[model samples]
Target: MIGPRERVPQAGRRGTRMAEHTGPGRSAVVIGGGLAGMLAVTALRGHFDVVTVVERDRYPADRTFRKGVPQARHLHILLSGGQRALERLLPGTVAALTEAGARRLYLPRDLLTRTPTGWQRRFDERRHPTLSVTRPVLDAVVRERALGAAAGPATRVEVLEATEAVGLTGDARRVTGVTVRARNGDRGAASRVLPADLVVDASGRGSRTPQWYAELGREAPQEVTVDSGLAYATRMYRPTARGEAPDAGVNVPGWPECPRGAAYVPVEDGNWLLTLSGVRGHHPPTDEAEFTAFSATIGDPYVHELLARAEPVSPVHGFRDTCNRRRHYERPGGVPDGFLVLGDANCTFNPVYGQGMSVAALGAVALRDTLDAAGGPGPGVLARAQRAVGRAAEPAWIAAVGADRPYVRGGGAKAGLGERLTTWYLDRLTARAAVDRVVGAAFRDVFCLTAPPSRLMAPRVVLRTVLLPRRPGLPRPPTAVEPA
Candidate 1:
């Protein structure tokens, strides 16, 4: 990794020179050194001779929080789909995470979820497995793996830390590189252009690609948003007694009728994260006393009961940027050639759904696959790759928007006949999923991104979800893994 003082060897305009000349003249630059940017670097291996990552904040030396990622203090999980994608990009990443104190929680089996109906059954189908870990740990491990993978003999990956990308270097027709400057507390540093064949905007939710495009006399990509006005507060805790810790995590999600939710899940270092959430009028409080008291008001009392036996280990942290926003970069003439957008920059889901990181990894995998299919960076390749990244985020986007549409202020627009009917069926399906194993498996498959939404419409799943009697879930959280 290159420090802020180090300069990437550059030559004159249009066609520039790489730091270490080898292979071809191809080079790529990724803006943002977060999880998405690191994975983007891994994907560019072999495809680009030299790949540079520009990051505004210097990464911490250890597994600790940094200003670059404000949500690092919150609970984060890598879903089954994301694990597979990360492993594909950099082999054994999941195992590396687990070895570094990340906990593996099987879906529905190791997680106790309370739907609108009641507490869901603990089904040991073992189809989907998720990793529960602090965001810092996750970022550290993935960053190490991705950087390590990028250090092959074929491709050279350079990380420019404490560097900021100011704008694009090319016209609206095609991006040639990025104009960046050192962010090392120097206000007078002159901006310089780093020429590249491709530029990936992985700057995340704070991306200014739209404004950059406008500066180039091009229209910004169309955007869509679905905000439920959800806000959440999180704090770390450790059980007062070793034996007092629950065997599994608890999640009591909000519904339209209640609109209050809570999740208490175990993380590394014998710590657990308890996050309390609510929409608009019922936002969770950040006060110490009120935070604990609010846990009791959620749909289920199991989390509140667990909190009573746990001692607080960290101050409460609240996050309110829960809106689901998508930039339509895949549409025709939306983005110029040689430029691509992925991760949160393209589609950002409400943090409550826990889909952001997974979607980012999936998008990187799509980028790698698209580049492989196209052979290398060329005319129309970046445009096609951007569309592929968009496709990767579709499942999570649909699920989040559908879930939040009901909570939008003023009820938004009236649903069409098909949407209304689909919503009706989904409500019943969600209720049925809590108790029925078949329905639960189907529902989880889509929720985990391991299967398409059409999985819920399978004949067997549809019959069970439609014809079966609406049975309530277990009245209490099951202490055992499987039903007796």
Candidate 2:
């Protein structure tokens, strides 16, 4: 918990080392300059003397999309758990984001959310308040803070834009640095190795750590991917008056019968981001006419009605290939010392769950605790840190994979008894939650990641779900919130 204005450590160049890092002289190299990379920089404040963040794309001014991140145009909102974790790392970050036009919202109350079971009932007050903003805007604000530009003294982190990590520099036992290339096609400039005490492959979901490890004579980490084949079609629109549904966000989650989903999120600048999504063979279309029609395939058409009135600002954008990918770095022979991976590099969730960014923030916070426990960054601590990061991500992973497991199996691989029982209980919980305020609030806590999924399985919750008769599904979207 260093002050905002503290003299941040400035690490100097330290080359290759076979032995583990001892006392001080702490330094680190973070590959990838996205939200995870920035937060990692912030977390390394007290522990490292020098930290370098190497990004492949040159960042633009403000919250504009960078070249490397194709999903920046998609709708992104920070879950409550992530927001709190971020604020803990960099104070005033939440205020900075809100000042930049990101709105904080209540979970089921502020949004018209139709879950797998039914519509979520709104309440006058709730604890889970999530932050809404475009991916680019969120990245920019966090980058500014992590780079020492947001009210903090000159930080230890140095940004090397237009740079990419090509390979690990050390041997199989331990990693000491990384080989990098400037994205600029300078044939004359040869590839160079940047030395460091530690290296982080936060290079994202497409990270080549497996290949790099293979080249270093180490076994590749076990990779688990559950591809539900979910596709996203997003289009930006001018804000339209709520009229009947006075909600800040609208979500219709897809279920088996209605295999389609849709969401409308209020981003900065009075704009709206509406996305239509589906799984496997039932992907949403990008055509204007078909996109609107796809909305009907979902549970409700309220989102379509609202979009019909709003003016289109951006063309329809489609993103496919969203799969839940989890690399088992915690397994033996999975990770090397003095090197670790976080964020999408370690685990990539199905974006439809909206847990990626939140998990990333949580992983960063967990990294801080791991570093403190290890008493500084070094070879001895790298594996433990990776395990801790994986632990922090476990809850989100379970929620996402559990929900998506049924979809991908396509009537073949049936969900185990545990999953079946869990789903049945949750579905009942959702039905009762629509009419019950306390139940709704508790559900919102798990949805927003403010609490663990185990809360839904509590004796009280289970008993209520089992004893109470199911409430009638809302005849329509819960457009108007009744004052409680």
Best by TM-score: 1
Candidate with maximal lDDT: 1
Report, for every candidate in turn, its global Cα lDDT versus the true structure: 0.85, 0.77
Query: Which portions of model 2 show Cα errors greater than 4 Å?
Result: 1-23, 149-155, 187-189, 240-246, 410-417
Q: Candidate 2: global Cα-lDDT?
A: 0.77
* Tens digit per residue, CA lDDT, model 1, 364-439: 9999998899988767887888888999999888777777777877544444565556667778998999888888
Count clashes in each candidate, considering only residues at least 3 apart in sequence or on different chains. 0, 2
Task: Please report how far candidate 1 places residue 125 from its true position, in Å.
Answer: 1.4
